[model samples]
Target: MADNDFVPLTPREGAALGDDVYAVLGEAILRGTLRPGDRLRDVELAARLGVSRTPVREALQRLERLGLVEVAANRYTRVTEAHPDAYAHTTEFMTYIAGDAAILGLARATSEQHTDLIEAVDALIARSERNDGMGILGGTTAFYQLLIRATGNHVFITIMREAGLALQRNLQGWTQPDEDVELRTTRYRRLRDAVVARDGRAAESILMEPEPSALALRGRPSLG
Candidate 1:
């Protein structure tokens, strides 16, 4: 990495410091600031982030756990290639989990929460209309975040929070068919209306259906 490429961060102290570093570096990787096969040296990152090497190493360890980076003792630590299968698996995982979350959350959501979810789904529909890939990705994530939060399951919330970065990376470049955008937009509208009506089963069924993607969620081929 070039010296100019590394952005310095304000120094932080204590346990949360590690998390901040992890987020910074993880976001860098996701945004292609740190591309695949790029090497990471703790000392350099420590200096760049204005922290001790220990926290930099800790951050790297966390990234490695998420499959964003690969590490070898006394060898090298580098960003991993964006595996095609990861995208398929992530979508599959998200489809089912979001379906379940919808059922639980819609049952428990207040009127205010229902309004927020409807707004989020509206954003998704707008993004779909323009075929905005990244916008759709972000809007979908936000909509689901609200849905999951409504479920009031702490463990589920924590798990999804931990997996958020990996999910973003894996879902990058994932898109549905152009022809199906209108269909999906209709589905999203139905989904929004279902949530507004507090029809949990209808919302869940809409989300659980397979989208128009090469990587079909239903009966997807397993990796060897």
Candidate 2:
């Protein structure tokens, strides 16, 4: 591959060097700038990001745990290929967990939290309208993060983060450009109303609705 094929990454500017490295590398992988089977060498990444090998190593290990990267002992590390079953299973888990969180959130959310959730959903609607897949994903994640946090359960938050990462990875390049934006907006509006009304059952029901199949994964070969 040409040098131009690789996207340049800047040095860490945040206090959490490990987290900063992980975020940059993870976004690159999710955006397909780092494709499946692409070599991820600590020395190379450290140099590219102007970070030390320690943080790069830590970031790589974290990505490995998230199922985004695979490592061969003392040999190599590379991005993992997509697996349909893994995607399906992870989506299912995320949906259930998010539904529970929605219910809990509605029951526990303060007036201010309700306003924040509404804003997040509004952002999601806007992103969806423009068919901005990454923006939509980010907005949806933020909305759910609020809900998960409202539950006051650290374990659910952790699980959601892991599942959300896998879900986003599987959804790379997937967009419902022709899907009805109005319908989506209305559905989320109903969910927001339910949350505001503190209707736990309704919020869960709204959130538990089936998701469309990932057309992007339809013809892709699954990794064994």
Of the candidates shown, which would achieve the greatest TM-score relative to the real structure?
Answer: 1
- The most accurate candidate by lDDT is 1
Clash number for each model? 0, 0
lDDT of 1 by residue, 1-224 (tens): 67877677765655487888998999899888999999999988988888888889898998998899999889999999877688778888888888888999999987888889989888887887787766776787788889999998999999999989998887675654445677767777888789888888998888776555321223233332
TM-score of 2: 0.74
Q: What's the TM-score of every candidate structure? A: 0.85, 0.74
Itemize residue pairs with steric clashes in candidate 1.
none
Model 2 agreement with the true structure over 60-129: per-residue lDDT tens digits = 9998988899999988899988775764565566567677887888788878887887787777667766
For candidate 1, the C-alpha RMSD (Å) to the true structure equals 3.7
Q: For candidate 2, what is the total of clashing residue pairs?
A: 0
